[model samples]
Target: MRLQTDNDMVGKRWRSRALTDDEFDALSAASPEGGFQQTAAMRRMVEQEGAAQTELVGLVDADDKPIAGAMVAYTQGRFGLEGSIWLGPLCDAHNEHLLTAMTMALHVAAHKRGAISVSCWPDDVYLRRTSDGEPDGEPDDLLVGNYEKLGWHHAGFDRGYGSIVNRWVYVKDLSGFKSADDLLKSYSKNTRRNVKIARNSAVHVRRLDRDELGVFHHICELSSVKQHFQNRDLAYFEGVWDAFGDRAEFMVAEIHLDEYLAGWQDKYAKFAREADRLEAALPESKYPDDVRKKLDTARRNVESAEHRIADAKERIERDGHVVPAAAGLFMWHERELVYFSSGSDERYAKFYAPTAIQHEMMSRCLERGLHRYNFYGISGVFDDPDDPGRGVLEFKQGFNGYVEELPGEFTLPVDRIRYGLKAAAAAVLHH
Candidate 1:
């Protein structure tokens, strides 16, 4: 792919060309919000699918330095093909002129490649944090405005949680927090309790190696089946693990039944001893009913703890040393650590493994000096309690994260007649 130039933009000479792997990597690294999606490794994964023609188009400055670019996977239309669906585009939105020029050149290239329309889903805008350390709801007007001015039409926001990319996200600022205890303070009271519950239950969380991809995939499959959602094949996950390398992490939560049982047994013995001492100290006639009730409560706690210990022992005797409960996949780039996917075993829901896994990851992010922890996508609609995504919204809300509304998807037409025809065909097919 040779360099294509456009000298029409006033005062600025713009050019677009295919970027080399090193150039693409360097430019993506330089962009403020660029992620692993725009990397050469991702391009290779997409190419492996053998479904579309992939290109790394770079927008060069006057000095020939690459400033803006997009990794576009174009699917050429067959017969009277009219348009192509371009996946997420990576570009620097801070520079308006360069952004406009690059987008225009991309449209021209799409047209030349027999595409009447081109669609782009840009990266999510990072909202600022307020004084209270919560993420502020600030829109990226300059970026969205540039796209609108260039004749890109905004697609409606995601509904029923059925979009390739989410238009709304939840994020937590982890910059100032020094320790896991400080981070826990930001969560809701119930979330804190859940984390404690998982910790006390002896659930251990750790990152998985590349060889453990199958284990994570199995957990994901189980979750998908129970939740009635579709899960990608194993190859997709393998690609992500391979593409992101150190930037990606798969964390799994597990439990050792013997250890949990031992802990509960120790607690039971301590409670029993305290109850026995209190009963011996308080004479039946001298002590008030309230004082006697304290002893009774302690005895009841001992019984409950003993029961839990017995149950855990039974489970350990029947099951193995370690049992997996939940798993989550994360990606870290620059200042953001994104929780990309999660899965858990239905049987272990009582263990609350996800909470522990998430807390551990957040603490690790703080330790590594990351600025923010992104909970990724949630539906913007929160009014209805029965909405499909309401539970997800509530779950993320417990972490004290703030909502961010993105500009969403946009489509630009290079050939109006062909675009109209394609639209009509799509509508007819839908009917």
Candidate 2:
């Protein structure tokens, strides 16, 4: 449908309509505001699963080049048809005219689909913040005001994880990094130590194929249960793999009991030999006290290695030759590599598999020349030590990144009567 601002009667002609898959791909990829949720692949994935009816809608200029776009999903909610946009409408938020026209087009599109209302949480950041969740800059009230002027209802800035999508994320900038070693050097000391420890413990990571989705799903299930959070099943992961194809990577961090045992066994023998030689030399050395101290340290190292070897043997007997310690899902984009989902088996927490997986993914991002590694989603509750998100924040902090606070969601009531009725009915039902 043709869309134009009432005030710009003589401006360039523009129309909003359904875009073809290829059109959406090229347009969204070029749009600075575009994200994975606004892609044609995401629409196909949702449609294949019968989850929602999706439209790849866009506003195009006279030459038919897209000026703005969104992947809108319509699902029947208790209140009627509910439409949502995940990280879009892909357009320059600074241009009031473009945003206004896009919002109007979305309203018409959702209305045509019989939606009561449409909600959007754009990818634009609203404020700059430190990694610790401390605000570092002023909020963007101008952008919020622009949406309000377009008759969209601005949702209040609610903290924590209540939005349809995460409003806060942690991202590491790899612009100056030349290699994985450079990225590693930028990490917090503890993160570097954890990566080293994981490596020393024989934790290794490898990419999984579509057929191995269940292995990653199992890891997710275990992690969700421990965290008391709900998790998606195997089918969902398979769907993601099928939809994203090579763009999605599922990696598992595992430990081989035999390898672990062998490494420790060799270390133990070396430590034992060192201790024996040191003790034998203690009687003849000019620095007798130093020799004795060296002998004691070598013996302690031997004792530790023995304990580790015994533990590896026990694990081999109970868990076979290899054990999957953790798994992570990553989505690749030219702008960044997103750490979408991840979980670790608490039983193998000591192996620090999650940290290893993160280091591996970040290294991959650097290899691809991507500057941003997005550790998506953290609750905006840094001051509250009792908050469940505190642990998540701390884990991400070890990698050294800044926090991005996104503008909250906004809604446009396509059918006011239906929207109000649905709200009243819901209130009465709850009452």
Top lDDT hit: 2
Error at 104, model 1, angstroms: 2.3
Worst 10 residues of 2 by lDDT: 1-10
In order of appearance, the predictions have TM-scores of 0.89, 0.96
Instruction: Please give, for residues 48-72, the per-residue lDDT of candidate 1 as tens digits.
Output: 7776677787777788888777787
Query: For model 2, how does the per-residue alpha-carbon lDDT over 1-431 read when each residue is reduced to its tens digit?
Result: 12344536414557787888888888777777666777888888899899899998788898878778889999889878899899887877778778777877788888888899988888888998998878889998888888877777887887887547998889888899898888889889999999999998889999998888888999999989988889998888899888989888999999987888999999999999999999889889999988988998999999999999999988999988989999999987666788999878898888899999999998888778778888999998888889998999999999989998999898888899998998789789999
Worst 10 residues of 1 by lDDT: 1-10
C-alpha RMSD (angstroms) for model 2: 2.1
In model 2, how many backbone clashes occur? 0
Clashing residue pairs found in predicted model 1 = none
